[model samples]
Target: MSGRIDPEFLRFPFRRVADAALHRALEHGAQHAAFRFAHTLEASWRLRDGRPAGTRSTTTTGFGVRVLYDGVPGFAAATEVTAEAAASAAGRAVETALAARPLAVGRISLAPEPVHRDRTWIAPYERDPFDVPAGEITALLADYSGRLGSAVGVGHTDAMLQVARETTFYADTAGTSTLQQRVRVLPEFTAHREDPAGELVSLRTVAPSTGRGWEYLTGTGWDWDSELAELPMLLEEKAGAPAVEPGPRDLVISPTNLWLTLHESVGHATELDRALGHEAAFAGTSFATPDLLGRLWYGSPAMNVTADRTAEHGLATVGYDDEGVAAQRWDLVRAGVLTGFQTDRGSAARCGAVRSTGCSQAGAFDQQPLQRMPNVSLAADPAGPDTEGLIARVEDGLYVVGDGSWSIDSRRQDFQFTAQRFHRIRDGRLAGQVRGAAYRSTTKDFWRSLEAVGGPQTYLLCGAFHCGKGQPVQVAPAGHGSPSALFRGVDVVTTRGGAPW
Candidate 1:
């Protein structure tokens, strides 16, 4: 069942503490201030060969204050939940900002945002995972693993479940106050096989991590039983499959694999911070520079993409960002041209946008918010073909599914991605499974080669729990939805020996 805000979080005197902190920061000569009280719960369980390997649970609660003094921003956090502690933290933040003002590069100016009073939002999820009995969850996972273990030629099986609940109370000097909670879970299963020659191969489930709850693992969202039953067979086939003969060939990429390509190429590249060189220390700057906006032919005319924080079941979905900017949706690429950039308050103002795109986010209460990615996704064709149809259109190519190892250049332009399974397509049909296959290309060249895309019926929402960025390192969850797509004359490579087999 869909969950409401946990009553325990409401019991915390967050509002009183936030008001006290804001009052103190303003009295300390701060231009802008924000207070965030956050509580997070995380649990992880792992199983190997039908037995529990480990299980762990963690809970953290804290509050942080951010302030701008003389155009410098500073932050401080504390685990204490008292108004006095909040005021002290705010005072310290102001002091820190004042000390750094002398050497600050430029005056901090934020984009204007309308005040939103007393707002609350909860992510769509049925059945809180934490409320479920640990024994029951473990039993289900073990049963799936046991099934896989019984498959012929299956050497071993591994399964994992990760769930998180995050609650935040945000208040700012601008009169915006919001209480938000979200739940997300990820379940994964893998089967391995080894041939007599000692060559090892494995296949993993395509079930994606999502903004769901315990129900997701209970066959509410994904078919765990069917996927688990089929994984061992797929693994067996992959182990005996021949290595791919690499060359320029057509490729039909499924949503399972294409989501990650979109994440690295379009999602990160379109962040205003990355484009303006402010985020180059951790991840390299983007090739999609601001100057190229509205002029660069980013892909084929059929290509369109959008950055959305309000997408249903999106991991990044929220009522408002850490900066109190409302969540939004906007086009980043339209008709194959660069059109927009994801932005936070400062970046939005620097980029001449009237308001932030709600891209600012922090991994936890103790961390400062950074310009992070939203749910950037490719727009599916309204009346395009299905996966089978897309494959049929390819005379000779490879059908790639499930994300595996990936490498992208600093600029997010040149890259290569391998998949969990690769099926050879010959004469407009799937020939057989192929191993050691990867596709490599420049971002623009790769997207521009898109010859067709499947319809909405084939679209899938997929994402990762850890997208690492920024100095001191922060991780954010993001989602990407894409339909099966066909690209022509792409560079297909054999990754095993760097030679065509």
Candidate 2:
């Protein structure tokens, strides 16, 4: 809502081309058609040990046309932005649809969407990252890394910043038209140390990739200075920490770590495509099959999860999905039962849904849109306690913070996750740091064991930029928000290097 679309992208005759493409598709007897022009910009910087290591920037621009001809779908994209090219792409799309009609699995039908006209929206941001001088950005990262390097007991440091801007213009035969833009940035810093015995230990910032601008790295969104100052001490403590004993125990999982759990367990598991077996080759199928909707006991009564594409600052947040469906929010799990799944127009029609949840997305203009995950988040309890209060309730448990290595089975069921840092909780207080701590549990079992969740104050929005899916492999950004949660009787394991002899 704050930033504007790139002037250069707007300078192109996108509307003229879209009108030409839509007119051609309809004149060719297509029942439905849409045109989209997209422009994307990305910049990345890396620093190691307070020195510049690498820098890169890229820009991509293109337009695509999608058409439904005689109930068969077809798509075509080209980098050329002209009225003639748009018409040509539309003709090719119709031809492709006609050629594939004989092998159609079913009559391609799209869920109905209310037409919107001449609308514009932008993701909230104060400053565009591209406008910032690269040299200035590098200097900031170096200063932060230099502080960590000068810290006692710190051996090395690494820092990086990644920023992206995306602008899109969409038009459809149904009279819906929109122009939108969004910006996102991610900053990270890690500190490393080595024990006298030559074992390595490291601590990295828990700041998640966010839908914000360059201001995020300068302390507008995260407290970088404080976190950087604390990393060295944390890394040193972890280096000498004792190993965790493997056993069933109560655990307090911080939002920093729990967000990833939500992303993998609930976010990906509840995608309609994954649940219905339409998507299997890449991330595997889901156990939350369509047949279990409204019946499967997915978690405790306190558990509630929602899939939202409208959450402010959510990495996957957008005004409209690739299918031209307006962004929406709906429940995936409510009162512990599997109630819904993230959906696109085609998937919604196939699943007997009235409308999509607006999950369709394309990583780039040249790529076809796929049913992608949205901003799936765990709802926080309004009357629940804060993180420290949740920790106080655990008599003997482990406090896990920040996500580390993780693995999940093809069914999105059985899984194990390690943490960047762990603390032994004794008698409702953090006793000391521990190393090589991990937890393993099935998706259903893990959710069922969630006894309590922290209040809104303890909730954090965090996620990854590289959530890979689809057969051709498209990486989409998504956010997962969760509160610090207490899980009862979880199986904690001691990892390889930290095993007690």
Candidate 3:
């Protein structure tokens, strides 16, 4: 257990305001209460046509109070951190809860979790990107874009860099206090070329954002220089790639592309809120009903997926969930079976789980925390063969790398995914690059078709920093680790209706 945040970070105004808010809520007859303060710093840089185009930075700070009165929950937040304002906000929250008491559901009870005080955790990073000059970041992106345009047939290129840092403080009456810091960086670029058929083709980088600092940009998790240099060559190769003939074939899907597929299909479907029919408008409910838990076959025998809130460098890693539950991990799928669901303490208690795994999250001070996703990932098979060996065994297939556009049904049962680069395979060898390729499958069929997984060396952690769900649209950062896996007899589709390349 750890104490609150550093005194330097917690100024007099912020701490005093939060203390006042909690006291006010308690005085207003709140059975339980918690206070949170957060500060986020973010910057974005974009380059187009070998020149700096856009650069921006933003900062936001706020504090919020959550209260339970007569077993009904209420919340209120304020950007202004004055003691008087904080007390008034808490008073308002109590009033709101009392007004809604008549319509309240069952009593609110959070699952018991270990107390963690006098502890501190920070995301791994060498240099803080925020301290760097904005112009320097733009110059780096522009340099990469310039190199991409040097290709003979390449027309234009786009480069982007993003860095973000978050500081959070949590306190609850149950004797828990956690102060945490998180960092993330994302660098991406794209190159486009025109062909004789009056069509345009493009290629993009295959790297993912991570919980690191400027070190990630320079070359920590990824080799930015090498990847930047290879972009032009890969783009050229893709420009001349042939379109695939639609048919069922063996497919090797890379972590770069599988991450997003997991995001849309597996990630959202496992949310307890979605399964319990809470997310109806923003998207339809999931097919993963509570009735299917522990019974549904989610994948092949080699499949294992874990939902984690404490994986180092994972975007969702945190010391404690928004609901004051300490961070934890649990199995979502094991040996092809649905074993668990993403849950908050409330849902966990309702579902009779002994304890919650700390999946609760709120995008901002004003939003109600929900059972958000953690770093859900497919475990690599330690005994499995490597990707190259799997390719050697394939008589015919397509190797899909990186993610492009994707479409899936509202229920997350059916989907079609395109790739940034596709390599055709014939007789256990890479034939060449291919374009106009997409793989479609029902969720069950897709996972069931998975025949083999690559070894740990081929596994990569990749994910988006922004996954949107819920009304008012909360965004959470998440990552997925997976290896290149072979699927048997997946349906392939070719572009039609004069589609753009």
Candidate 4:
């Protein structure tokens, strides 16, 4: 709630535009209206080998108006920030709603919510990444890449850093208003080496982006020095190791890899809109239909998941969603059964829920908001063992770290995932690094195979930007938290189609 809020958060004429837009919408016979504005600044620096390869930055600003007119919804947006433009957009939004009323699927019924007033929420941060000098940013990237490139067998190194600051304002005719700002950063490094097979192999860092500022890159959340020093050795070991033997094998998956699995399988699958078959295309419909709510066994009894928007430094953490509903935490799975879904005010009402879970989000002012995924995470068992302990419990298996390429059906059921690095495990110990390993399984079968998870000490918050959805393809940021997990008898494959040798 307290931090260095970006000046751009308040520089816009939020109240003036909102008043004009709402007044006009009401005059046009709209029952409800909301005004929204957003500004985002993004910058990135990249290094190759030992020198700067590229650098770029961009800024975008826009405002939009939305209205509920005679049981239908309409939206319009513009780059103009004036009150006059907002009023015009409001009128157009009402017109759009009127035009669609005749063909509307069903009457819109939004869940009731308490009006929140005079609210200001700022993402926690110590230093602003944007405020850092460009020279400093490039110097850091170059230095990291150079250090890695100097290592033996390290033929090439790539380093990059990207930062973004998003500011938003919202005001609804229901007497809710919120101004918010968030800062996020992502930094990555990779090393390449030629393997004994004379094929180039690559390995990258496993650190995930978070809702933090410049401080994150400077050793706040991650141990950069240790990771950089270990990269070359890890890559060297991986390049010469044998290709994974494909078959059913016991596996211990690190949180770095598990977070993405949760994001794709559990997080996206449980969205109310997708589950109810009201949203589709960008991501396919969900198999967890309404009829299965509280009936489907999503996983083993060890699987417990929560959808939240208020975890510290979480990418999706916020005080309020685009719909003017307060952020909340709710169970998605309990004792391995479907318990709830991520919902917004409208989706909640449609699904017979009493209140919103505040999952609604829009990437920018020009886009229509939808019920998006929150920071969905698996809860760690209080008495569970640590990661090392989990590994010790595995007799013969593969241990995978970091996420790689993945694919799943639109139903979020059957899927395959590869990782940055995999190590063969024999007799409860890692034998050596292995190359070209991927795991394939259905969502239900995979989760059911989960035998145990590391305790809270092994949990990590990880996620990415650019979660894409909707027709025009709106992108949102999200987070997922998980612990090192053990899965019994999982199918493993070699990317190069190798057999046991």
Clashing pairs in 4: none
TM-score of each: 0.98, 0.98, 0.95, 0.98
lDDT tens per residue, model 2, 1-501: 388779999899999999999999999999999898999998999999989999999999999899999889999999999999999999999999999998998897899998889889899999999999888999999999999999998989999999999999989999999898999898889988887678777899998899999889888879888888888888888888887888998999998999889989999999888898888888799999999999999999889999899999999999998888899888999978999999999899998889988898888887778999889999999999999999999899999999899999999999999989999999999998987789999999999998988899998889887789886788889999999999999999878763352
Of 1 and 4, the candidate ranking higher by lDDT: 1
Clashes of 3: 8
Q: How well is each residue in 89-161 modelled by candidate 4, as lDDT tens digits?
A: 9999999999999999988888988999979888888888999999888888878888789999999988888
Which run of 10 residues does model 1 get worst, by summed lDDT? Answer: 492-501
lDDT of each: 0.91, 0.90, 0.83, 0.89
Global Cα RMSD, each model:
1.1, 1.2, 2.4, 1.3
Candidate 2 Cα deviation (angstroms), residue 412: 0.9
RMSD of 1: 1.1
Pull out the clashing pairs in model 2: 1-122
Q: Name the runs in model 1 displaced over 4 angstroms.
A: 498-501
Per-residue lDDT of 367 in model 2: 78
**Order of quality (lDDT):** 1, 2, 4, 3
